[model samples]
Target: MQLSIYSDKNYLPKGMEPVPMLYPFWTEFIPSEKYPWSRLYGKYLEISNSLFKMTSLQEADLVVMPINWRVIRGESWRSKINKEVESLSIEFAEKVANSGKELIIFFAGDCCVEEIPVKNATVFRMAVYRSKRKQNDIIMPSFTEDFVKEYLGGQMSLRHKSEKPVVGFCGLAVKDSWEKKLKTVLFHGAMLTKSLELGVSPYKGQILRSQALEVLAESPSLVNTNFIIKDKTVFLNTQDVEQRQKARAEYVKNIVESDYILSCRGSANYSIRLYEILSCGRIPIFIDTDCVLPDESIIDWKKYCVWIDEKEIPHIAEKVAEFHDNISDQEFLDLQHECRKLWKSRLSAEGFYTNFHHHFSRK
Candidate 1:
């Protein structure tokens, strides 16, 4: 599929570099020459370059306007960018429609929805943090990466499981706030938190996560660590850089060794750990908190991992044990291999856009 990119490169703010949406923070640490950060930003810019053929708008199948607007709360550079992008998006949409080509408004922001003027257009966002149903067409929540290189490197030895089943989790266990409780009551639903003036509520995951941690803490087969958070502030044992690195190393090791790792929602309705678990070729005990996965219409998430609802928090141990006991040794190993294959083929950025391009081409 031929995709044309339209952008006001000269008008971009100072210190801003032209890169794809949801660019990883660790890109600075890893030299671009040695290891490229996915296919969109760095040296291995194969996926975007191959799939999206940058050409004149008059002769393109699809037109993409990359918007760097971030919908954050305070009066900052984000707010300034949001305003600039909003106007630019409107202008771009009009031009694309006039040219008789489908427009893709690619937003590198956390906004739930940004309404464009053109009818023949699709909006893509990084974080769909809104509770209400979106008005835009084909909006997707792009996933972020933390340690893709390390996770992929440790995939070979990740198939070996311990003698006994172990469920592991290493992240913040936040508590629900009173405001969130009030909003839940007023809205008559926990998932929709727009009434509370919040993009995404931390309470949705916190409630289930805290309950699961409580139940799993007593279980003999669980290897977990509760990084407690009081009022959104995480309380860790040590703040030293070396200690933090050691802790992260230990966390990854646990995820790689354990039979299943707890994949629960955090600030957003989705968890980055879900992808990391798949990258490591390990099963994820997905705690569904009214979450939406990318390409849900095509991907059968249940077939890949054990899906558990928030209401089933009490019976988590039982559910995991039942799943473990039923599967044969060979089946377990196969599932591990399948997890890695799924990540590389569907979940990763390259795989995602490749599949997305194919899906778009069909339409």
Candidate 2:
């Protein structure tokens, strides 16, 4: 039942910003600013690996590691990651082959999804991508449905395919252009402005659970991005980015005051907000490409919510209006219901762990 999750302090972010009040979880512990394991454990899973040691995966039922420079820290990032990968080489993957233990990697970005030749380790990618296909044999988890169900209560009972004209967005979306000092805000602002014109309810905030809940309440439709991530210290290596706390509050307040939320993939990983939106009892208006969704055979995005092509973002209002006309409140509710069921079965940590256990148990 125990697992090892590798990450560092930036797992949540630091300073002038307000994050979820995640603390005192028996299983949670922040190893260092360079690695944040505290954000994953406690009621989730108790972590016990210090450095990226082969023994960790060899010893535990499963070892979950993030293969990214973001989590790696310092100029030594690439080398450290490769060193660890080499340690878990084919020879290592084989040692734990029959140990009833497994190794799961948190890989969803463009940076580390490339194929790394390793011997014995089993790599599970969180989001789908071409690099994932080349780098490792992808292992899809079973947390999707269950995660949706638990967080989304009554909404899970409704049909979302044809819900009301409500729209909303979950998670964070800071354009960062408003920062007077970080002069590049103008460019980032342009991107945000483009997204807004595309039909996303504009809100200023970081990705916090309550804010996510609030965003959905505002509009029946929702918009999501990678919750938008950057180094706590941006390009200049200073935590000068404006605090998203104000934005979070404003979004929640607006959710209580508005109608639809929009969820879209921001910079990296498909924003978890897609589920969080459904969890809040609203439909997700997702815009993405074939690269990020789960297997098409198992997931029908149109069946649950409106889907727009990544390139078609400017037509967001048109798409939203079209989707709304096609479905009724009952259907929308059903879609929401289906959303919750999907998250519960596939997105939760417990479900992930269970799958990890099964992967090693075989043979």
Candidate 3:
């Protein structure tokens, strides 16, 4: 199905092809109008003044909107200023939905995309690594489900499971300062330096994505770190930090070689890796400080996994040793089996995508 994504010219779905994109984020790294299935904003949809002007909505089957992906620069809860950008985008989305074309928003699982009114649109969430919404419009089409199915059951369709543990992240890296109203950016290098000071170099803390791949590619014993802070309620990733692509690569490689992966998060938001790890067939060592999941969620969690208190991290080495010696191979495989079953029933990519596809088609 041709999905026309209406996002800034810079927000290209990396490696996303075949799915048609009507607009692109204008950026240097991403070539505009040159790539197939993606194009400049002017080529299809146009948005300004809380309005959207477009001619192709009638013919298009669906609209994949990366809406609310840019709220980082515009609002702060403590600041007097409201989230102007989010307000504008929400308005624009309403218009598109009212146009009779089913709009599918690529909302972050953990962001405020929920603020947008869905009167007519069917919001579809694609979690790269983490999702924040307690109840997303739907949770299918997860890379977890796709990854398992592709390797386990061969299909001829264009879609296949995404590679496990991609180095993608969704969180705030910077925020608009309250005093200056000027956005303060976090540099990646700064965060890495801080991680080093903590004596847990990000390079060593549960490495993922590219790092995990390398580790898995080499062996199944790579150590990767997961990060989560108690609910600050911001959607942007840790900011003002400089992105060192090489370091990220090395980090992911480390995880790829390890048998266990770290799944960490804070306050109401679980680590995005929870879904990723279960789907990828890796043992996840969950780090939870105090939050206890519900009986159903807990049964589900225990049916396939392990959990440790955040405070125990200091003694993680001993804990790891204990678990290694005590856990039976059958127990481990049972965890994998239940985890995969949960993924299929509750978090498969195909299930959600099909719902999204049908929703758009009906309208």
Q: What is the TM-score of each candidate against the true structure?
A: 0.75, 0.51, 0.41
The C-alpha local distance difference test score for the whole of candidate 3 amounts to: 0.39
In candidate 2, residue 230 scores what lDDT?
34
Task: State the lDDT of candidate 3 residue by residue for 22-78, as single tens digits.
Answer: 232233343455532232122232322122222355665555554333232222222
Give Cα distance to truth, residue 126, candidate 2, Å. 2.8
| Backbone clash pairs in model 2 (N, Cα, C under 3 Å; residues 3+ apart or in different chains), count | 99
Residue-by-residue lDDT tens digits, candidate 2, 44-102 = 33322221122343344454333322232212112233344344333434444555554
Candidate 2 segments whose C-alpha is farther than 4 A from its true place:
1-91, 94-104, 108-112, 119-121, 130-166, 169-260, 354-363
Off by over 4 Å in 3: 1-63, 66-68, 71-88, 97-101, 117-136, 139-246, 253-258, 266-281, 287-304, 307-327, 330-363
Candidate 2 C-alpha error for residue 198, in Å? 28
Which portions of model 1 miss their true places by more than 4 Å? 1-14, 19-44, 69-81, 107-120, 126-155, 160-164, 177-200, 221-244
The CA lDDT of each predicted structure is: 0.59, 0.41, 0.39
Q: How much does candidate 2 score in TM-score?
A: 0.51
Candidate 2 C-alpha error for residue 246, in Å: 5.1
Better of 1 and 2 by lDDT: 1
Backbone clashes for every candidate come to 0, 99, 63
lDDT: which candidate is best?
1
- The weakest ten consecutive residues by lDDT in model 3 span 196-205
Instruction: Choose 1 or 3, whichever is better by TM-score.
Output: 1
